[model samples]
Target: MKAETVRTTLTIPRELLEATDKAVLEGKAKSRNDFVVQALRRELAAQKREEIDAALAEMASDPDYQAEVLKLEVEFATAQWEALQLGETPK
Candidate 1:
């Protein structure tokens, strides 16, 4: 499917615009819009990764979450032992 695009104007420093033009001429990007879009996508992905990392860090510090994980670990261990005794491997 083709995505819709909107025309927008931005104010950038002269040197930065010059650099972007140079990059476009070098075939690094199809155009200034493409370069900007790629940059935005990369930055958005980076921000999303940081958000996930922060959530994981917060979850690690959560005592209730830790207790639940430990409980599950013990339950799984017992189940695995029972399966082994029955000569069946638990998946």
Candidate 2:
């Protein structure tokens, strides 16, 4: 893969910027860009995982929904097994 470099601008409160600078000076962060990028990525990943887990919990809590999902999964696995036995592709 090729690497591309792009430049962007950010506007943050003075205090926040100062805090970030202080963190870097104190060895908390290697670089301001690295710190901000990592923090943003972690926050976004957590939000997405939380949403998925909540939805899964809701589905599992409903007996009917859980049954339907289990049925579908079983059907899917059975179809895949049959396809493999027959040397055919499973949809």
Candidate 3:
């Protein structure tokens, strides 16, 4: 399936545009359009990850969530310790 695309004009620094063109000539990208699309996708993905990290940080600070996480960590450690005492080799 082909993705829907739009035609638009952008004003970028001359040096940056030249670098994109060079990528095409160097066979790093099939064309200027491909380079720009890949660049935009990377930037968008990074932004999304930043947003997710921020949200997770906020959640981590919540007292209820913190307590639950702490409880799980303690249980995990206890289980590992018990297993070791039983002469079980952990993978």
Q: Runs in model 2 with CA error above 4 Å?
A: 1-5, 69-91
Where's the lowest-lDDT run of ten residues in candidate 3? 82-91
The residue pairs that clash in candidate 2, if any, are none
Estimated TM-score per prediction?
0.80, 0.62, 0.74
lDDT of 3: 0.93
Better of 2 and 3 by TM-score: 3
Scored by CA lDDT, what does every candidate get? 0.94, 0.87, 0.93
lDDT of 1 by residue, 1-91 (tens): 9789999999999999999999999999999999999988999999999999999999999999999999999879988888788886454
